[model samples]
Target: MSTHVDDADRLARVTLSRTIEPGDLRVTGLVSELGAGKVLGYLEAAGEVENHWGFALAQELGRVDPAQVLVQAAEQGIRFIVPGDPEWPTQLGALSNTGALHDRGGEPVGLWVRGAHDLHQFAGNAVAVVGSRAATSYGTEQASELSRDLATMGHTVISGLAYGVDQAAHRGALLAGGPTIAVLPGGVDRPYPAAHAQLLDAIAERGLVVSEAPPGVGPTRTRFLARNRIVAGLAEGTVVVEGAVRSGAINTAHWTTNLHRPLMGVPGPVSSAASAGVNQLIRLGQASMVTTAQDVITDVMTHAARAATGAEQLDESFVPDPVRYPQSAGPGPAAGISASRR
Candidate 1:
């Protein structure tokens, strides 16, 4: 398949992403049907979007300048990748088939990528390792070991680049001399936890850093939820090393299960609150128990590639309970932004 998208469409996507947050299914549906340029035109000419936040962002079009955005990104060694771009990961196509979880679902309109690796190659056959931002030592160690072994065995690791387990997983992949992918909730130009800037730089040198948010944007709760889906979508399977009952990793696990990918949980001490969510998942039959890297590899390999085409395996009526993202607020940039332009 050719990966050449028109520059005009690419520029339109940049503007759209600038005005919209990632993973707005309503807008994604429109983009899937009308094309980015046409969709932007529609928003620009008039707010024809019905009962959607996109209508709210229709006025923000004047603030978006795709050409300037591209220039700024280029200066920072970042590239904007639209759907048909050569570096676009085909695995993300699976997201289009998955149902909403926390009201955020759909393929991203564009991705802001940094680092040397091509997302198309690394994402499709990867394994996601995620957990709480405030993980326990045991959790981080297990995530690290699992990622290290998976890397040594030639599996690319994908994570959300958060604190705790996410950081450990990336470090493990790097230590094993394997490429890893970090999906962020903010712009590629700015690392969310500023303290991890050096780590982010190191990953960029050896792997890839990706985000759906355009450059200059910051992270938000909804953006983090959206980023979780991409982490699940990029990989063939996912492992939750540890998660609080209401943590983002649990959110990611739901995305994995809903996507029909294999979901594995690393068992922690019975009393550890950090592992509560993981234990709950395993106990509830939402995830299989996995203790070692080999166990993870076995399960992941046995069920690999299903996430990208497992519509039959997934329950169309499935709805995740204990929603983490706030239902009262939309996953937009600001109060009225509403990820509206995509």
Candidate 2:
């Protein structure tokens, strides 16, 4: 059974979800200090403030009614899980400590989830596999095989529902008869990229479809970037199969590393443009190289056990060394064209 939340608190968080963008530190600080209900009340009462953020909050409050948003969400089979709810994934609280990544940091006020599985349980042992939307055949195959092997080992696979690598990873988990979670940039009710609607539906049937946005919202470039933090936050580790230097997968990898979570990258052919980001990550000591499911599981579980036993703090030497780029290959200009254009 689901845990009960107070009507006012639930309404406040739902209202905030619609009004404030995810990871807004200013709003998060206000809510943390005054509570969501009081923050909403303050917003409702404020006339105008000189600050841009304050002005925006007041304007947003004028147009939204929490009660109506709740009604719409319920009608669409979506439930809002707040910070203390039984279904909330507590691991996400780690975001609160991410000081400089403020644009993509701060704990979400709540999540809009559509699925049967418990969110906390579903995320407890998950590993995220993300990569290029324009992945090569080798990248797609590697993502699928790794996802399948991870699933067979009882790990839940998590990914964005984009084309190429993300799609292949989700499919591999399904084919292995394992649960998979899809984190969306838009509302849980609306699938972005329209083409992946069926794939998103299939994932929700077995696992979950999650979003920080409310039911009627659509994706934006900022929202897509912000969404990567959640993908990294929910998983025990993150793997980038293939991407350019500035792709979304690399963004997710940065979040994983910032949170001190296990970050891994799979190598592709040295000649492949798609492998550039992963190769760069490994070369710069930003991530470790992982070729197989066992490699990922070993790293994840070792870190988990270390954290559990406080060995991570007591002895730094016990932790695995960062993987280095192979010295055998002669260095040239890094594999792909500059990602600034992308």
Candidate 3:
């Protein structure tokens, strides 16, 4: 299944992944224009005369030997999937349009994957469930129940594998014997929280644990933020169970909105601070209020079916325009929900 050209491309992407930070525009642009092998060749050469940033990146590239990294990854059962790979999730292409997430918005050069399940299959019919790590019991229960219900309906549950809501969601999906993908901020081989080492291992055994970083790299705040885009991009929709008004979950919601994907939020007790972000999105009409998993499945499938058939003539009352909920929009509860046709 491997060709010489495919091997070279995969190695080049692994090198690039090690050389630059995730979502770095400079490297993305260079790889887009010259291809990864050429970019590596350019880095090997010492003739870079302009762009201080490019020069610095080239200097860093010289330190990494791509072949060795590949060996290390293979020893650990990791595989690098490039754009041409069949396992590469095509939905990630939507990230190219999310300029607000990255300065040089483009598809990832490659992904460092560690799992037996195909990435494309895991992403298909997926719904990302994200929220604050500091979640309350109510939030945790809701996330778990919703994920269980979604998984029972054959939708792959996707999350960042963080604490609280994410943990609950992943566990719920696993309990239902459904595939669950954990998009990591750090390397798939290095679980960030450390406590989740067993959890991550279980996920890789049954589903997937993928990242942009190489094997030895650990997570930083910046990596965590950047990885949110991948989580949002891989899913057909994103659900925020509970979070503050300014949390990473909200950031993921923004990415989902930017990609024109269905965004859903589970309402929690108004008295709980953890529910602030979800309530805010609902009040501003940025997300559809989804109380149950059936609500999520219906909304996601309805949107997908409509898009597939070019049936853009849905009743205006059923489709809420996200544009109406600008960042500066004031607080007001969303209007009545449209009845699900199914």
Off by over 4 Å in 3: 1-5, 41-47, 102-105, 314-342
lDDT for each residue of candidate 1 in 1-342, tens digit (9 for 90 to 100) = 365898799888888888887888777768877898888887776666657556677878888788998998999999888787777888787788887888788888988999877788887668999998888888888888878877876778999778899999999999999889989999887887998898899899999999988877899988998999999988988999989999899999999988888999988889999999999999999999987655665565445323434654534343322131112122111221122111
* Per-model tally of clashing residue pairs: 1, 0, 0
**Candidate 1 segments whose C-alpha is farther than 4 A from its true place:** 48-53, 305-342
Q: After superposition, how far is residue 41 of candidate 2 from its true place, in Å?
A: 3.2
Clashing pairs in 1: 54-340
Q: Could you tell me which residue pairs clash in candidate 3?
A: none
Q: lDDT per prediction?
A: 0.81, 0.82, 0.81
In model 2, residue pairs whose N, Cα or C atoms come closer than 3 Å (at least 3 residues apart or on different chains), thus clashing, are none
Candidate 2 lDDT over residue span 26-131, tens digit each: 7766776678898887876664665645676778776778888877787887888987788989998887776535365677888999988998998987999999
Q: Give the lowest summed-lDDT range of ten residues in model 1.
A: 324-333
Full ranking by TM-score: 2, 3, 1
| lDDT of predicted model 3 | 0.81
Ranking by lDDT, best first?
Answer: 2, 1, 3
Summed over model 2, clashes come to 0
Q: Output the number of the lDDT-best candidate.
A: 2
Q: Candidate 3 residues 76-141, lDDT tens each? A: 999888777778788887776667463524567888999888998789769999999999998888
